[model samples]
Target chain A: MPGPTALNFSEATSHDMFAQRLPQSKDDSLPQVLAAAVTHLHALIRELRPTQADWRKVIEFLTDVGHASDERRQEWVLLSDLLGASALVEEINSRRPKTATPNTVRGPFFRADVPQLPLGGNISLDGIGETLDVFGRVQDLDGDPIANAEIITWQANAQGFYENQQPDLQPEFNLRGCFRTDTDGRFHYRTIKPCGYGVPDDGPVGKLLRQAGYPLCRPAHLHFMIKAPEFETVTTHIYDGSDPHLAEDAIFAVKPELVRTFEQQGKGWLLKLTFIMVRARRGAGT
Target chain B: MPGPTALNFSEATSHDMFAQRLPQSKDDSLPQVLAAAVTHLHALIRELRPTQADWRKVIEFLTDVGHASDERRQEWVLLSDLLGASALVEEINSRRPKTATPNTVRGPFFRADVPQLPLGGNISLDGIGETLDVFGRVQDLDGDPIANAEIITWQANAQGFYENQQPDLQPEFNLRGCFRTDTDGRFHYRTIKPCGYGVPDDGPVGKLLRQAGYPLCRPAHLHFMIKAPEFETVTTHIYDGSDPHLAEDAIFAVKPELVRTFEQQGKGWLLKLTFIMVRARRGAGT
Candidate 1:
C-alpha cells in the first residue's frame, strides 16, 4: 500500500505532531499524557473507519454526559463506571495483597462523620425493609485482628434509592452508620439488606443503557470504608452473592473475594465475613 | 494466572455482559453502534492500562469540552478536528473520482443562504487587505465545463477572524458571496486574501493546546461549496501553498490537491483553478 499520501495521511503525521507538542513541565505531565491519549484515540478512530455520522454521534453523546453531570449526579463518573474505566482504575490503583479485601467503588451515597454507634446498632431509620446484622472482623494480612479500626458503612435502601436520593421521603441517616472494631477486631451493625437496583438511569448514561438493552442495575451490596492507623484505608463493597446482577454489575466491580452469602435467620438475615487489611506503604498514610 | 481471580476478573467477563445488554431495536442501530464503540473503547483501555489518575484526567478533559461548547463555538468539533476525526470522516464520506476536487471540513463559519452575485463581482465589503480576483471553471470528469454551477464562497478577513466572529467590526457578508458560473463554466469574484491564524483558542481546547505545546494556527484558505443539478455538491478549501502552516493545519484538513498558488498581478493577486465535479449518484439528488 502507498504510505500515507496526503489523501490518506491525517493520522500518523498528526499523531507525531501532537505527541511532540506537549509542553515540558516539572509540576505535572498531565499535558503530555493527554496528548498521548489524543493520538491513541485518533488512531483508533482511523482503525474503526467511522463515518461522519458516527463521529458526530460520539461528540453528541459526550456533550450530553457533561450536561447531565452535577455535584450530586456526576454523570461523567457514571459514564466511566459504565465503560468499566472506573473498575479498571480501582484495580490499577489499589493492588492489594491476595489476602486483603478487594476494593470497589465508593458510590455517591457515602457520607463522612456519621454518628458512631456501638456494636449491633441499627442504622435503618426509615424501617423500609428486612433487617440484617452485618458483622465482620477487621484482620491483618496474617489473620491477626486489627483493633480500633473505624468502619464507615452505607448503602441504598431496599427500594433502590439512597436516603440522599429521596431526602423528603426518608428520615435522616437512613441506612448509614459508623462503628469501631473491638479489641477482638469484631464489628457489627444492623440495617436493611440493600436490594439490587438500577443506577441513576434517567440521565444520558441511562439513555445509553436503555438503548443498548442493558439493565441499569447494580447488584445488591454493602459499602464500607475501613481505616486504621497502620494500615491503608480501604473503600469497598461486599455484594450479596444471590443478587441477580452479581454476574453483570453495571460497573463491573464484582470480585470473588467480595461476594459473601447472606444466610436467613429467624426474623431477617446474617452476613459474616473477615476483612483483611494491608499495611500502608511507607509515607502513604500521610 | 488463575483465569481472572478477584484482582483480574472484571474486564473479560463484563465485556461480554455489556455487549449482550445492548437493546434490540429496529428504529436505529445506534445502540448496536454504541455497543461496538464501547467494546472497542474498553479493549483499548485495557491495552493502554491507564492509571486511575490518567482516566480521571480524560473524564475532566471531556467535561471541559462539553462545558465549553455553545451554538457560536463548537469546542468539541475543534477537539475532533484537532484529533483528526473530522479529516478521517471527510475522507470516508467524500470519496471522489481521481479528477474531482476533494472535500474538506465545512468549518463553523459557513453561513447558508449567502447573497448570490454576478460573475466578476466583489465579495469584500471591508476591503481590509490586498484584493485577489479568484476565477475558476467547474467541469465534469471528462474535462467538459459545467455551465451555471453555483459556487458558494466564504473566508476570514485580513485579520484572520471570520465575519461572524466580529460582527461589529466587519460588515455583514464582509467576505462571503455566492456566484454562478458564466458561459464556459467560468466564475470570478474579488475578495481580500485571508491571513492565517489560530482557531478560537480561549476555550478549553485552547488551554489544552497551550498545555500540549501545539500551535493553534491554521493555514490561510478560502472555503468553497459548489453544486449543480445532477452532480454531487463539493465542500472544499483552497489553501495558500505558501502559508507557513500548510504542513501543520490545526484541523488536519489540508490535502495536496487543494493547495493553490497566488500569482501577483498589477494591483492584486490572481488565483485561477479548475474544480472538477462528479455526477451525483442516482436518486441522491431527490
Candidate 2:
C-alpha cells in the first residue's frame, strides 16, 4: 500500500498556489515579467471565461501565425503592428524630449546593404513616379550640424510596392539608398513619391484583421534610419501630410511631427525638412 | 502638389485611437475578447517598457514554439499548461456544483479510439509494474445509480511512457480501455500502477521551464472521461494521494477531492471511488 497523503485542496486558494509555484529564474526580470504575464493572463481568462473550444481556437490561430512566418516574412510582427503593440512599445521606449526627433517602428522592409549615393543622386532608378527632391540636415537639438552622419532611406514606388516585394518588375535598389551628411550636416537625394500600400494580408494576421473589419492600408510614408557616433540612432518615417489614410494608418504609426507637405516645384515636387538628433548619455554604451 | 492635410497627431490619445479603430465583428464576443486582450497586452508593455531587443526575443520564442508544433504534438498547449493557463481556463469554464466531479485539463495524450473492455478486464497488455484494481460507481447527485454510463480511462506504464510515445516497446492500446457501468452503477478495471512522467521536454516550452527552474513532472494520475445522455461530460484525473509530486503537480491539476489512496488487497492493490455527475441544463445543446 502507498503511504498516507494529504488531501487539503481549497478552490479559493488554487490560483494563489499556482502563482506561488511559478518557476524562479536567476535573471530577476524574467521572473517578474513572467509573473506579471501570468497574473494578467489569469485575469483575462477569468473575465472572458472562455470555453474549451474558444481556447482551442486561440491556440490554433497562434500556430497558424507562427507557421506563416519565415526569414523573409514575419506574420507575428504584422500581428503586433495591427494590434498597435509595436507602436505602444515604441512610445514606451522612446520617450524623447520635444526638441529631439521621435522614433518610430523600423518595419520589416529595411535592408542594411543598399548602395551609398552622392548628394543629389537619384535613388529611383526605374523612375516610375513623379520626381521628388528631398533635402534634409542632420543636426543636434541645439541646432548644431552633425557632420558625416549616415542617413539610410527607402520607400515604395508609385504602385505602392517596395523594390524587394517586386523584384522582377522594379530595378535593383529601386528607391533605396544610403547617403552621408556633408561637413555642414546637409544631404539631398532624388526619389519617386511613394503611395499608400496594403500590408501583406494573405496570412493569418490579415485574416484576423479582415474578420475585425479593420483597414489594411498604411498611409504613404518614407522610412529613414539616421545614425552618428555619440548619438542615439533614430529610426523614423516622414509621412506625406496629404495622404488620405493619414488619419487611419493601419499600423497606427502616424505622428504629426513626422508629417510634411510636399510643395510643388516646377512640374515635380520638393520636400525639405531637418532631422534633430539627441546625443547619447555619457558612459551609456549603445 | 498634394492637397493640404490635417496633422493633429496626439500621443496621449494614440492608444485610445488604436483601441477605437480595432476591428468590430458581427460576433460580439470576438470584439470583446480581442479588446480585453489588447488592453492587457498594452498595459503589460507599458509596465515592462521592454526594449526592442526584448520584444524581438518574445516574438522569436513564440515563433519557435509554433514551429515545434505539429499534428502529433502541441507545443503551444504545453506552453499554456506550463504557465497555468489551461488550468485557469478549465476552472473558469467548469464551475459546477460541489457534488459534481470537477474537471481538469484533458491534456494532449487522449486518443478517441481505444477498445472497450468487459468488467474486471485488464487494460495493461504488457502486465508491467504492480497490479492495480480500480472499481468505481457512477451516479447522480440524488445517490441513484447511473446505469450504462460510459467510462473511458488511460494512463502511463511503469516506465512512465504512453504507448503512443513508445510504439515499438508497448502493445497497441496498452493501459487504455473503455467500459460501461452495470445496472448497479459499478465498474471495475485492472491496470498497472502509473508513474509520474515528464512532459515533452525536447521542445521550446521545455526550454522555458528549464530556464525557470520549474519541475517538468506531473503527479501520477489516471485520466477518465465519463458521459451519459442528459448529463455533462467530465474530463478529470484520479491522482495517487501518496505520490511525491501531488503537492506540486507541474500542470497544477490536483484537487483534494480528486486524490485517493491505494489500499493493500492480498497480493495486489485496490482503489475504490465514486463519480458524481451533474445533469445538463435543459435545451443546452451539447
Task: Give the per-residue lDDT digits (tens) of candidate 2, residues A1-286.
Answer: 2222322323344446555666555456776777778777877787787888789899899889988987657788888888888887778777679989998887767788899989999999987898999999999989999999999999999989988777899987899999999999999999988999998777898887767667788888899999999998888999998887887777777777788998889888999989999988897533
Per-residue accuracy of model 2 over B50-150 as CA lDDT, tens digit each: 88779888888888998888766778888888888888787777768998899888887778899999999999999889999999999999999999999
**Among all windows of ten consecutive residues in candidate 2 chain B, which has the lowest summed lDDT?**
B1-10
DockQ of candidate 1 is 0.34
User: Candidate 2 at B55: error in angstroms?
Assistant: 1.5
Give the range where candidate 1 chain A is weakest over 10 consecutive residues by summed lDDT.
Answer: A1-10
Candidate 1 regions with alpha-carbon error over 4 angstroms = A1-43, A107-125, A142-152, A163-190, A228-230, A263-270, A283-286, B1-40, B108-127, B143-152, B163-190, B227-229, B265-270, B283-286
lDDT of 2 at A87: 81
Candidate 1 per-residue lDDT, tens place, B5-116, comes to 3234455654555666666676766666666666666766766677665676777877787777765567777777776668767866777887789888877678886898
Clashing pairs in 2: none
lDDT of 1 by residue, A82-180 (tens): 866677667667678787887777665667858888888999987879989888999998989999999999898998888877888888788889999
DockQ of each: 0.34, 0.40
| Reference-based TM-score of each model | 0.82, 0.86
**lDDT on C-alpha atoms for all candidate structures:** 0.79, 0.83
- Tell me what TM-score chain B of candidate 2 gets against the true chain B: 0.90
